[model samples]
Each structure stands twice: as C-alpha cells, then as structure tokens.
Target chain A: MERKTLDLWVGLFVVAGLAAVLVLAMKVGNLSTFNMSESYELKADFGNIGGLKARAPVKSAGVVVGRVTNISFDNASYRARVTMVVDKRYQFPKDTFAKILTAGLLGEQYIGLDPGGDEVNLKSGDNIAKTEPAMVLESLISKFMFDKAADGDAKK
Target chain B: MLERAITGIRGTGHRVVNGVWRLGYASRFFLAVLLHSSMSFRRFHLTIKEIYFSGVLSLIIILVSGLFVGMVLGLQGYETLQKYGSESALGTLVALSLVRELGPVLAALLFASRAGSAITAEIGLMKATEQISAMEMMAVDPIARVVAPRFWAGVISMPLLAAMFSATGVFGGYLIGVVLIGVDEGQFWSQMQAAVDFRQDVMNGVIKSCVFGVAITAIALFEGYDAPPTAEGVSHATTRTVVTSALAVLALDFILTAFMFRGL
Candidate 1:
C-alpha cells in the first residue's frame, strides 16, 4: 500500500475506535443519564433498607431526581441511615416521605419520595423524618398466616 | 529398570529448568522493549503502520463476531426472560455481558490468533533469514528498530478493538431485540443505560482490554525472538504464541476481574 493510503486507513481506524467508545459511554452506558447540575444531599432513616444499594435511583413522582450515595447503619437509632444526592431543580417539602420500593416483582430496589404539603421546603443536609422501610416478604407472609389462624379461632 | 527410572527423572528436571530459564528471559525481553520504546514514539509513522496492520486489518472479524454474539444473547435472553414477563431487560443482559466479560476476552483471543501469530511468524522469519543479525552488523539495534514499534502498536490497538467489539455487539442485540422481535425500543436503551454504569463497568472493561493487549504482544514478541533459526522452529514459535497468549489472557482476566468487580 502507498504511504498516504496507509496513513488514511490508520486514521480512519483510530476515528472509528474513538467513536465506538464515545457511543458506549453516551448511549449504552450511564454517562448521559448523569446530572451535572448542582445537587444537594438529604438523609433518611429506615428500619430496613433491604437490597437498596448505593447508586440506586431516587425517584419522585415516577421520575428519577437523585441517587443513593450512602447506606449505613446508625448504632444509636438502630436504623439504616440512607444519604441521597438530589438535584437542586427539584425541591421537596419538609415533610417528604421516603420509602424503599422495588420496580418489578424480582427487580432491584430504589428509593421513592412522596412529597408532603408543608410551608417550608427541605434544605441540603436536612433529614427526612417520615420514611417507610422495605416490605419484607417473610414478615408479610407470617402476618398473613397469623391473621388467618386468628380468624379460624374466632369462627370456632 | 532403576537406570531407566533415573533417566526419566533427569529428563523431567531438565525440562523444568528450561521452562524457568525461558520465563526469566521473557521478562528481560519485556523490560528491553519498554526501554527501547523511545524510537517507536520518535518515529510515530512506524507505529502507525503497525496499527494499520494489526488493528485495521482485524476490524472485519471483530465486528462480525460481535454482532453474532449479541444477536445470540438477545434471542436466548428473551427466551428465558419471557418466562418471568421481564423481556424488556434484554438490553441489560446483552449490554452487561458484552461490556463486562465477552468483549475484552473474545477480542483478545481472536487478536492472539490473527495478529499475534502473524507477528511471531514475521519476527521468527526475520531472525531465520539473518535480517536481525544484518541490522546488528550495521551497528543498528534490532530491538529498537524492529521490535518496539510492533509492541507499542499492539498495546494501542487492543483497547480500540475491544471497544469496537462491545459497541458492535450492543447494536446487534438491539437489532434482534427491538427491530426484529418488536420489543419496546425505549425500554431497551433506557434499561441498558440504567444498568451499565460508565465508571464501574465501562472503564473497568477498558482497563481489562489494555492489560490483555500488553500480555498478548509481549508473549508474541518473546516467542519470536527466542525461536531457533529454522522453518520448523518459526512455525512452532507461531503456534506457541497463540497458545501462550490465549492462556495468559484468560488467567490475567480472572485475576483482574477478582480485583475489579469483587465485593460490588
């Protein structure tokens, strides 16, 4: 091959390679979903977080507005302390309720935020007071069984 | 009988010693290539030519294989996920598998057979034909002039090829999942984007490819340089290049994956 032709082909190969990486990052990976805007942190305590992991989506009104950044255990409170980074564009009320919710029957878990009617908005570093723990299947099934046994006794 | 048993033990010891000696020599060669790499950088066109030979020429096979792999994943994933009525996650299955494991591993395997064997054969032939000795007789260092460019080129081309493989594979999955089978296109892309994290998954894959590149090229170069100067020896060196590179890539992949994706 001619020197010029070789150079052209090499240049094209490099270009294509770089373009592939760019596509992987922007389209296939989560690079495009990242919120580059200013964000603030909020903490919520739950009795059980279940499988809610860091980087899990934090959604309000079925739209993802933040991500779980930290999940830790609070020794004094005996609860799970979950920290989330929320976009500044969406502000929640002081009484917003945070709950652990699963997407599908067997899917990953995430945090769901339900806004409350309050005069003041929650600020950065504020703790959300109202929170719901993840629904544990074992406990739910046991409760159902207990209720069924109680109903049978009452009928007798 | 006792004399024969002693001979067998002697043979085994000789082979073991020879293998260890060769490993030490390969390590030395690796260091020499790194030291002599300045020439490859100073004359960038030399490295570019090698990239054209190794990277550009390997594009067709890499792309076609990626597509086929992705399509197969799409079909199989759909079949299994449909049982749970979660077929929308076909994209997640295909993208994660390709990006995390298959892309770098399969691409390196193919590269080892294609470009790596070719490099070993070429260098072995050069040594057999006295070309390396001729360069040395002319007071030119053969390692710098002949070996460094190809070494750097392999290192540079590897990650690019793997990325191309993964990107192509994802498209193939999309074609089968969304275009042919009529899955929701929005769900396909959104699910993939949500599941495949840029820093955790994509970057780690890139790191894996780069490591594979270094290992394959070093093995190829060392095999060629150490081969005996004969046609049979050169052919054996080429074969060894492919086999050793493949084993090295797999073993290194396990170690890297353990360190990278563990406890996550």
Candidate 2:
C-alpha cells in the first residue's frame, strides 16, 4: 500500500508537472488568439516574408499592440498578403503606414505601424492603405557580390 | 631539436589533411546509412513496445535532470538579463532557450550517455554470445528485426523525452523566477508569452532532437555490431559508443545550427 501510494504520488507529480508546463507554454507562447478588447483586421502586401511568421508582433511606433495572424499570397498580383489584428482600443488612422520590420540584427520580423494624422479612423475591417513589403537580406548580399563581380570584370 | 620541430609541423599538417579525408569518408558512410530507411507495421509495433520500455521508463531520470537544469539555466539567465535591465526578457530567454536548444540537447545527451551505452553493450553482448547469429540462422533478418526496431524506438522516444525535458525545465525556471527571484507571476508569464514563438525555436529544438535521436541510435548500433570479440572489447566498445556519440551530438549540433541559420 505504501509503495502504491508512492507510485500514485509520483504519477500525480508527473501530471502536475505537465500541466504546469502546458499552462506556462500557453502563457509564454501567447496562445491566446483573441482576447482583451476587440480586434481590427488589416492587410499588407509583401514581396517577401523575411523572418515574419504567424503571430509575429504588430507594433505602432515601436510599441507592439497587435500581431500578424495569417499569410496568404495572391498569384494574380505576385504579392504576399498578410492579415494582421490590432487591439481595438488603439485606433488606426486612414494614412497609417504599415511596415513589416525585423527585430534586432537577427530577430524575427514584426509589423510596425507608423500612425498617421488623418482625421478618418479605420473601421473594424478597413485595410491600411499604405504598406511596405519585407526586405531580403540575402538578396542584398547577393546583389553586392554580383556588383563586385561586375566591377572585377570591368577592370579586366 | 629545430629539425625535429620542423618535421613535427609537417607531420601535423599531414595529420590534419588525413583527418579531413577521413571525415569525408565517414560522411559518405553516414549518407549511405540514411538511405535504406523504411518502417513496416510489424516493425512499428515492436518499436513502440521497445520505446515504451527504453524511453518512457526513463522519464524519472529526465525529470530529475530537467528540474535542476531549468533552475540553473533560469538563475543564470535571469542574472545576466537583469544586468541589462531587460529583466522581463528572462521569461523569453528562459522559455526560448529551453524549448529551442538547451533542454533537448542536454536531455538527449544525458539519455544518450545512460540509455545509449546500455543499448550498445546489450547488443554487443548478444553479438558476442552468438545470440544474434542464432537469430540469423533461425531466418530472422537481424538488421530488420533487431536493429531497425531499436533505431525506430530511439527516433520516436527521444523527441517525447526532449519535450518532457523542455516543459519540466521551464516549470523549474518559473519556480526560480517567481518564488525565488520575486518576479510577479503575471508579469513573468505575460512577458514569456509575448516574447516566445512556437514556430521559430520550438521547431528547431524538436527537429534537432529527432536528428540527435538518429545519430545516437546509429552510432550505438554501429559500435555494437562492430564490437571486437572479447570481454575487454565489449567494455571498450561501450566507452567508445558513449564518447563518440556525445562528441557527434555536439559536432552535429554546430553543423546543423550553421546550416539552419545560414538560410535564415
């Protein structure tokens, strides 16, 4: 009986440990999809994703108040469409410039908003009119390398 | 003495080139091994049973290790981040570090050192005792029946064990962060949530664990199958398996990390 009790306690401990981890995972992973005030959806057309992934932060003036939810591509326009949700309380003006930027030197990309001074406010589903696409660092490096090759050939 | 030193320099360069050539040869073998991989239903069933025994049963050690690991990582990470006045980044750091790299690597290393050597020794002993030969004589494909199942079990078990390690380590860190370090639970949790990405680093950790699993099992099995025919040979094989697998794990980590981050 004592051994059985010990076994049961260990089992419980394992379960408890897993539960704590789950809660922590959810909390830290930001698993809450929608909560705290209402949300408004906006879209951005990007040429590349950079390191931008789903749930990457959407920031206004460096303060993140939203996240990129879903990414879809338009074959017709050859543009990557990003769906973003911003906290309802913080209103987006008509001319707010949505630029997707990466954090730090090697951090994941986030959607940063440059709040505009337009008197008109975006409705619940209204799109942000101005947006910037993601920049490819690798492409830039390759371009530089090719430029250097061109210079070498010109000298030759 | 100066002539000897000059010769020594030349010899060192020769050794370095030979080492590189040897590595190229081994990689070809490793690639060959990566081929010819398949899992049947029967193989899967046996693999599951073996995994439950070898992997699931070893949860106690993983947990004991994870708890302490989480605490140590948390304490150290917190102190450094606090110095930068980005104390809140501790949650993000601890969570990302645990889920991304350290937790899985450390747990897998520990498991490899413990369970990996045991598996090698047991298999090596079987080979030496003619048990493997007997099974082959009885029409069992030793590679398929014994090796494949064991390999599959390691592949399946290591990820689950690694995840368990990550989870337990994070929880352990939380205990240090909140109870001991006095970060508010809400702040700690929210900061962690806002900062960590399940896609970026968690995927990396799990994927790395899977690779480590394959390496661990392959090296162990290789060492076992090639064990010299003596009792002392068995001991040497076991030691070699552990040491080689551990070093391979670290080396592969560097290579995989470089390749992984290269495109990024």
Candidate 3:
C-alpha cells in the first residue's frame, strides 16, 4: 500500500511537470499557433524588407493578429513580396496600410497594419496595394552625413 | 639547478598523464553503467524511486528560484526597456532569458548541489558500509542493480525539471510585468508568444538540461564509486560532485549555446 501511494505521488508529479512543459510550449513558445488556428493569407509588396523574417509578427494597434508566412523577391518589380497569415477573426478593410516597423531602436522588425476606412473587407487572396517599406537606419544616417557635408561645401 | 628544473618538468608531465588515466577509467565506468542499465527492465522501479528523490524532491528549490529569478528579470528588464519606451518587451526579455539561458543552467546547478550531491553521498555511504561488496559476493552486479538506475533517473528527470522551472519563471514574470507593474496582460502574454520559438528557444533549453543531467549524474556516480571507503572520503566526494557538476554544466552550456545560436 505504501509503495503504491508513493508511485501514485510520483505519477502525479510527472504529470504536472509534463503539463507545465506543454503550457510553456504552447502558450509562451507559440508552438501550436501555426496549424492549430484558422487563418487567411494576404500578400503585400515592399521595396525593402530590411531585417523582417518569415515568422515576424503582424500587429494592429500593438496586438499581434498574424504572422509573416513567406517572403520572396519579385525580380520584374524589383520588390520584396511578403505573405502574411492573418487570423480569420480579424477582418481588415481593402485600403488598410501595411507598414514594416521596428519595435525599438535595435529591436526586431515586424509588420504594423493600420486599418483604413473602406467599405470593402479584404479577402484572403487579395493583395494590400499600399505598403510602407522598412526604414533603413544606415541609409538615413548616411543621408544625414552627406547633407551636413553638402551644407559645409555650400558655406565654403 | 638544471637537474631540478628537469625533474620539475617530468613531475608535471607525470601528473598530466595520471589525470588522463583517471579520466579514462571514469569514462569506462560510465560506459559499464550505461551498458548494464540497458540489459534489464527489472530495476525500473528502483529508477522511479531515485527519480522521486532526485527530481520530485528538487522541485521546490527549482520552482522558487525560478520565480525569484524571473521576478528580478522583470524588474530589471522593465527598468532598462522602459528607458526606450519598450517596457512592453519585459515579457519577451524575461521569457527569453529564462528559456534560453537561466532555465537550463541554473536548474542544473541547483540539481547538482541538491540531488547530485545527495546521490554521491548515498552511494558513497553504501560503499563505506561494504554493501556493494556484499552484493557482489552474492552474485548480483552492483553496477546494474545500483548505479545504473540512479543514473537513468537523473537523466530522465532533468528535462522535466528544467521545463517546470521555465514555466514557473514565465508565471513569475507575468506576475511582475502584468499584475504589479500594470503592463497590459494581453500584451505580456502575446509578446512572449510572438517572440519565443518552440524549436529555437524551448527545445534547445531542454537539450541543454538533458546534457547537463547526464554529465552531472555521471560525475556524481563516478565520485561515489571511486571514493575511498571512509566517511571523510564520502564527504569529500560529495563536495567534488557539486563543484565538478557546476563547472561542467556552465562549460557545456557555453559550447551548446554557441552551436545552437551560431547563425543568429
């Protein structure tokens, strides 16, 4: 009886530990978000993606509503095409603005969706027409330096 | 003076060779335990018993420490990230830190100190009492009946312990980030869910803890088995088990992290 009780407790402990791991994997790690949910895909084109990865978050009002499913280059258009999987529950208008945004100065880049006033709700296969490309910090810094040098030359 | 210098160099070389020989012997012992452990299922109950002692018993320390560490991370992360108005990333910072680094490394260190030392002491006591010799005389292989079960127990329990630690740590971070600090609860969990990857972060942490488990248990059992059959020897071996296991866990963590996060 005592051995059986000990075994029972051990079994309970193992089960609890396993449960915690499952929760961690599912909730914190987002392991089940991919195949476990009903989502629809939308595509957008950007001139520059910067450091946006395939799994980057797609957020609206700072809430993640989807993920970047794929990123590809369109040679003819000279643009980076991004495929996003938005949750079925989140319906956005056709004219919603999709902007590539960074969380902080040195943080990871993600897609921020700004909903626009449009009578037509975007369908799954529809493409977002307007997309703001990722802001390149290096190019901005270089531009500032060049502008300063130009000003110096003008003064001289 | 020239002759003395030559003797000193030879002495150092001899010490190096002796250390290598001892390491080889310990490795052989570990192999023997591993081989014997696979040869039978009769000792499964014994392995479970050891797990109860090593894994279940160690849960309190692991959980409490994980919570405290996570809370501290929440506080510090909030302070740092708030500077740039990214205090919302507190959840991300805490979860990533615990899952990627502190979760496995600290749990293993604590496990080494708590259960690993206990294992060494228990086995050492058995040796001191000549029970191992008695078992051998009775035609029972002590390696199979004794060390292998304990070894397997440690290995199996480690990843579970680490996962539990990380889970609780995440909770602790939640408490601080959302409850006390008034950060949006939805944002805290959502940010964590978005940032942390199951394969990259969680699984790698599990792998690290599993490797640490094997290393720690092996060191514990080896020290116990090789200790001089005396009280002082047992105590000394127990201390060595803690120190050696800690250093091994840290070194292994560094190497594994480098490989696991190489491209990123």
Candidate 4:
C-alpha cells in the first residue's frame, strides 16, 4: 500500500476510535451531566440513611442539583452525617428540609431538598438542621401492625 | 508398571521446568521490547503502517460482533427486567454490561484471534526464512525494527477498539429497545446515562483493554521469536498465540474487575 494511503487510513482509525470514546463518555455515560460545574458543600444529619451511598444524586423538586460527597457516622450525635456538594447555580434557604427519599418501591435513595421560607440562603459548609431519615420497611410494617392491634382492642 | 509411573512423574517435572523457563525468557523479551520502543516512535510511519494493518483491518469484525452482542443483551435484559415491570432499565443493563465487562473482554478475544495470530505467524515466518538472521548479520536490530512497532500499534489500537465496540453496542441496544420495541426513547437513554458513570465504568474498561493489548502482543511476539525456524513450528506458534491470548485475557479480566468494581 502507498504510504499516503496507509497514513490516511491510520489517521481515520485513530479519529474514529477517539470519537467512539467521546460518544461513550458524553451520550452513553453521565460525563456530560454529572458534577461538571463548580459546587458548594452542605451537611445534613439523618437518624438512619438506609443504604444511601456517596455519589447519590441530591435533587430538588425532582431535578438533580448536586451529589452526596461523603457519608459517615457521627459517634457524638448518634446520627449519619451526610455531606453533599450542590451546584453553585442552585441555592436553598437556611431552613431547607432534607429528606432521604426513594425513587420507586425498590430503588436507590437520594437526598431531596425542599426549600423553606427563610430569608437567608445557604452557603458553603452550612449545615441544614431540618432533615428526615429514610423510612425503614420493617419499622413501617411494625407500626401499622401495632396501630391495627390498638384499634382491635378499642373495638373490643 | 513402577518404571512407567516414574517416567510419567519425570515427564511432568520436565514439562513444568520448561514452562517456567519459557516464562522467564518471555519476561526478558518483554523488557527488551520496552527498552527498545524508542525506534517505533522515532520512525512513526512504521507504527502507523501497523496500526492500519491491525486496527483498520479489524474494524469489520469488531463492529459486527459489538452490534450483535449489544442487541442480544438488550433482548435478554428486557426479557428479565420486564418480569419485574422495570423494562425501562433495558438501556442501563445493556450499557453497563457493555462498558464494564463485555466490551473490553470480547474485543480482546476477537483481536487475539484476528491480529494476534497474524502477528505471530508473520514474525515466525520471517525467522523461518532467515530474514531475522540476515538483519542481525547486517547490524540491524530486528527487535527495534520489527517487534516494537507492532507492539505499540497493538497497545494503541486496543483501547480504541474497545471503546468503539462499546459505543457500537450501545447503539445496537438503542435500535432494539427503542426503535424495534415500544420502549420510551427518553427513558432508555436517560436510564443509561444515569447508571453508567464515565470514570468508574468507561475508564476502567479502557484500562482493561490496554492491559490486554500489552499481554496479547507480548505473548504473540515471544511465541513467534521462540519458535523453531520451521514451517510446523511457525504454525504451532500461531495456534499458541490464539489459545494463550484468550486465556490471558479472561484471567486478567477477572483480576481487573475485582480491583475496579469491588466497591461498587
């Protein structure tokens, strides 16, 4: 084969290969959407995280605004301290409520930020005070059974 | 009967010793290739020619196999996931499988059969024809001139080929799930993007391909160089290249997956 033709073919192959990687990263994977912009950190404590993991999406009104950066046990407070990085573009008030919410009947848990009526906007390193823990299925079922038993007693 | 049993034990011992000796020799050859790799870069066209031969020529098989694999995953995943009424996860299943496991492993297996055997055969033939001896006599370093370019080309081509395979497979899944079946197109793509993290899944796969590339090319080159200068020897070496490369790819994949995906 001619040297020029070989060079051209090799060039095309390299280009195509790179383009494929680009497509995998941008379209097929979350490289285009996740953590691309600058972000601020906020901490919240939950009584029980219940399978919540780092890098889980933090959403506001069903739109992802950040990602969970770290999850650690607070020995002193006896709670799970979850730190999250929210995109600088989105800000919440000081009294925002953070809840560990599941997507479906069986799905990954995420932190849902419900903005509250407060004059002060949250800044980096700020801790949101109002937070709700993930609802454990066992606990919910036991509570329902207990309530039913009490109702039966009252009727008797 | 006692004599025959002793002979069997002796034979096994000799074979084990010979295998270890060959492994040591291969390691040295690997080092030599790395040490002499500057020539492949300095004379860039040589490597480019090899890239054309190995990478461009192998495109057809890679693409067709990738598409078929992806389509199969889509069908199978949909069948299983729909049992739980979560058919929207078809995209995630296909993408994750392709990006994390099937793409790199399958591409390397195919590359071992297609380009690897060819490399071994070519080099073994050159040795059989006394071309390597002639080059050595003329003060030309055959390792630098011949082996390095092919090695670098394989290494460079492998990751790219794997990426192309994965991307093609994703497209194939999209064709089946959304275009053929009545899947929601938005859910298909969105689920994939949500699940397939670039750094964790895609980059680890790229790293795996690179490792496979090195292993396949090195084994091919070593087997060819070590083969007896005869037609039968060259043919045997070519066969060894395919079998050994396949085994190496699978073993390395298990090790790499354990390291990369253990936490996830």
Q: Which candidate is the best by TM-score?
A: 4
TM-score of chain A of each: 0.90, 0.71, 0.84, 0.94
lDDT of the structure predicted as candidate 2: 0.75
- Candidate 2 error regions (>4 Å): A1-25, A34-56, A60-94, A97-156, B1-40, B262-264
Question: Candidate order by DockQ, highest to lowest?
Answer: 4, 1, 3, 2
List, residue by residue over A1-156, the lDDT tens digit for candidate 4: 999999999999999999999999999988888764588999999999998988788999998888887899999999999999999889899999999999888777889999999999999999999999999999999999999999999999
lDDT of 3 by residue, B1-264 (tens): 999999999999999999999899999999999889863357567887888899989989999998998888888899898898887788889999999999999999999999999999999999999999999999999999889989998998898899888888988888888899988888788778888988778889999999999999999999999999998999999999999999999999999999998745
For model 1, the superposed segments whose C-alpha errors exceed 4 Å read A35-43, A69-78, A87-94, A117-128
Error of 3 at A69 (Å): 8.8
lDDT of 3 by residue, A1-156 (tens): 377776886787789778877987898888876442688999999999999998788999987888887899999999999999899988999999999999878888999999999999999979999899999999999999999999999999
Fnat by candidate, in order: 0.84, 0.27, 0.69, 0.85
lDDT tens digits by residue: candidate 1, A1-156: 898999999999999998988989999997887763579999999999988998888999988888888889999989999999999899999999999999988887999999999989999999999999998888989999999999999999
lDDT of 2 by residue, A1-156 (tens): 254554454455446535544554465565553343577888878777766877778987777688787888899989888888888878878998888787665555888889889999887667777888777888879999999999999999
Chain B TM-score (model 1 vs. true structure): 0.98
Error of 1 at A119 (Å): 6.3
DockQ score of each predicted structure, in the order shown: 0.78, 0.16, 0.53, 0.80
What lDDT does candidate 2 reach at residue B166?
Answer: 85
Interface RMSD after interface superposition, model 1? 1.0
Superposed Cα deviation of residue B108, candidate 4 (Å) = 0.8
Q: How do all models score by TM-score?
A: 0.93, 0.67, 0.81, 0.95
In DockQ terms, which candidate is top? 4
How accurately is candidate 3 docked according to DockQ? 0.53
